[model samples]
Target chain A: MAALLPITHLLWDTWRGNLTVNPLQDWTFRTGDWALRLLVASLACTPIATIFGFKQASSVRRALGLYGFGYAVVHFFIFIGVDYRFAFDLIWDDLATKRYILVGLVALLIFMPLAITSTRAWMKRLGRQWKQLHKLTYIAVPLAVVHYIWLVKADLRDPLLYATIVAVLLLLRLPWVRTQISKLKYRRVFQKL
Target chain B: MAPKKTIMKIYSSEITPEQTYYAQSQSRRQFFKTAGLVASGALLSACAPSTPSTVDPAPTAIKPEKPVTAGQTDELGDAITQYDAISNYNNFYEFTTDKQGVAQMSAGFVSSPWKVQVGGLVNNPKTFDIDDLRKIAPIERIYRMRCVEAWSMVIPWSGFTLSNLLKQVDPKSEAKYVRFETLLDSNRFPGQRDRSFPWPYTEGLRLDEAMHDLTLLATGIYGKPLLPQNGAPIRLVVPWKYGFKSIKSIVKIDLVAEQPTSLWMKSGPSEYGFYSNVNPEVSHPRWSQSSERRIGEMARRRTLLFNGYADQVASLYAGMDLRKNY
Candidate 1:
């Protein structure tokens, strides 16, 4: 339900012609923006649940991942179907030349295996290996952030902010790092004693 | 009522394929209208005091508050982007990188009582007041402006030819290039503080390119004086080149022996070039220029060589490679 907001707004804007001068660009940006936001959100669930001791928060991680993949597919479809008109040669050229597009495509492909095996049946079939394979999200999330970084021309504030957020989230997920942080907080207390 | 005349027809050659593409554009064409356009036209017509508008004899000239005759170009049937859209959404990076932020920031910019220095390798070096330029140049033209970002718009611009201004200050035999400099006031333009590239933004044109009839030194569009955000007082309008080539709020015009390095060319030599012509065949390093989204329209149209002015300006690049130069 939360994921439908970007989709709904896109529909509303398209209907009213509310998108800025470049409607295609506006549409592409919004869809891609949401996909990245959701990817980041899914990555947060584990650390957020562990740190806050909110066991129930862990349940929404798969849902967020699936929804992010949905938006990713839409973003990819818009690029190819509308922007390129399914021109394979043009797509090939963009993929070859544009480093941002290449990174973005790699990010999208990373989500494919995780999304396909998201269902309970596939999770059960894959068993213990599923957890290790899904760890690829750590790599995918950073690539997606890098893709955003390359697209921006001058202003780096927004992209830099997102990078910082993703970096912090990744740090919180590392068990060794979390233990070190926990010890640092108590280190000063022990010295007082 | 003022008589609307088809001003000057420079190109007599056969219509190019690119021109035909604009005529029979695949997408549905919709040019939006704004109340500002009609309002400005009426205001300008009311302000003119029955004197001839073409040439003011004195240096202390009145602001060009009147509208120039903007007649349609022959065989160019693309619907124009309305006054408001053209005025609002733009890439005047001097003010701010944010498209919408420029208007507010540039409101305090004092363009009146401005001086443009025309110097360097020219036979005669002189600085002309902005008002004086208004009195001398009264030609207006409707042109299609395409940005390097793969977006475009058609606008009715009121101004005069760059050649007319260039001829006034005759170029010396050694002058191979014409370099332009925009007013670099960091006080008003916050973006100037960013030292990512050189400040006092610069652009250049080969001597022959500067002499082209299509090149214009525009003062206003849709009737009234150009809004502060739209490069108030004066700016360049190079139709065939990327919109960045049309530097805003120009203050300096230098005729140099060597090809002057423009802002983008200086910063990113690979991505931007000296000859930034509109070409469907040659793509930007990051994005494809094969197609562009017309500002008011929903669908993208295939980009054109010299922005459909190939027949007129292609001769300037005869026997030379465009891709390599680009």
Candidate 2:
């Protein structure tokens, strides 16, 4: 429910004519920003569960990833459909020349298959290979972050802060770091007892 | 009450003759050409400094006309952007990097009784009161302002040509460039405290470019004194270049031989260059600049070369490669 709040607010504000001077740009940024934020949140779920001994956090990981993917779809659609109006010739020039555009497109392309295979049926059919395919999250998330960093003209604070959070989350995923976190959680539980 | 066939024939006769329509278009084009010549002539005359003997000698504010109606448009027939949008949507990084926040952040800023120090490689160095500066040459110009972020606005700016300001303290023969510096108060401008940006935003222009008739030292927008967020008291307005080239809230003007590295250039040398002209062909490293969404307009229009000031400024960079310069 909280994940849907951004889109809901976006729609409400847009309908009310409360967007900034440039609504299309505002929509583009808002959708893209929410997509990045949700992806980061999704990535944090597993590590958060291990570190804090909250197993429920792990359950919503798939849902969060799907929501992130949904937002990414909207962001991409806004860029090519509404904003560019399916002007593939202009978009092609953008993809060929603009580093941010290329990076963002690559990130979205990686998310497509991950989103498709997220279902239980595909997971069961793929069996052992399912986890390996999903691990592409490692590449996709960082590319998304790079896409953001590249797009901002200056004032890297917002993007860099996101990059740091992502780095910490990625570090926590390391086998050694996960073992230490689990150990710490056990120690805390034992002390409580 | 006429029969259907007769009615159709009557409607067809009412259609405008193709020849007449073509002639009307030709006359309209001719009218625009004449208007262009007249507007440029008026601008040139307005740029000449008002001598002490010919005009009001005492220091006084250069007041611009009241808010323009929707019907009043720029020479290019672009509608003047609404003052509300212009005021609220600002890119003054001194207050904040967020465009929407600058207005509120700079609410309490003090721009009155401002002093602009002019010196360096000049025959005479002096500090001018803002009122005196305004009296030098007062004119209202509607210019298309294009940002490097691929957004644009048609702004009605009121101020004097920069040439009039430089004329007071004559530049020495050796002076090759003009440098402008913004206020550096961290308390007033919260964004200054951020170490990420080198504070006291600085920008420069070649002496010739600075002296161009199109180059204005804008003091007002929409015929009202500038709001703090819009670089109150004084700001540079170079229509041919990207918005960043027009540094805001200026405190110092120095005539120097060496090219001064603008804050943008210093921060991102590879991405930003000295001459940040509005050229669609020269795309930024991060994004395409070929198209820009003018404020209030949904569809992105193809970006024009020099923001459609190519006729006046093209000769300035006749031989140089803009791609390399940019």
DockQ of each: 0.52, 0.61
lDDT tens per residue, model 2, B62-117 = 11111222224566677667667888999998898889999999999998889999
How does the DockQ of candidate 2 come out?
0.61
Provide the overall lDDT of each model, using Cα atoms, as 2-decimal numbers: 0.79, 0.84
Q: What share of the true interface contacts does each candidate keep?
A: 0.39, 0.74
**Alpha carbon deviation, residue B324, candidate 1 (Å):** 2.4
State the displacement of the C-alpha of residue A108, model 2, in Å, after optimal TM-score superposition: 0.8
- Show where candidate 1 strays beyond 4 Å: A182-193, B1-74
- CAPRI tier for the interface of model 1: medium
Q: B1-326, model 1: which lDDT tens digit per residue?
A: 11223223322121122222233343313111122334444545766654434433222211121111113333366755655577778787878887867777777888989999999988889999988888874665668898988888887677888999889899999999999999888886778988996888899999999998889998877556777888988999999999999999999999999998999987888889999999877877566678787887766677888898877788899998999998
The digit string of per-residue lDDT tens for model 1 on A7-111 reads: 998999899978776778877889999998888899889877876668777899988888888898999999988877787777886687789999999999998
Candidate 2 chain A: worst 10 consecutive residues by lDDT?
A45-54
Judged by DockQ cut-offs, the docking class of candidate 2 is medium
Error of 1 at B326 (Å): 1.3
Residue-by-residue lDDT tens digits, candidate 2, A12-72: 9999999999999889999999999999999999887876668999999998999998999
Error in Å for residue B46 of model 1: 13
Residue A73, candidate 2: alpha-carbon lDDT? 93
Task: State the DockQ, from 0 to 1, for candidate 1.
Answer: 0.52
Q: Which pairs clash in the backbone of model 2?
A: none
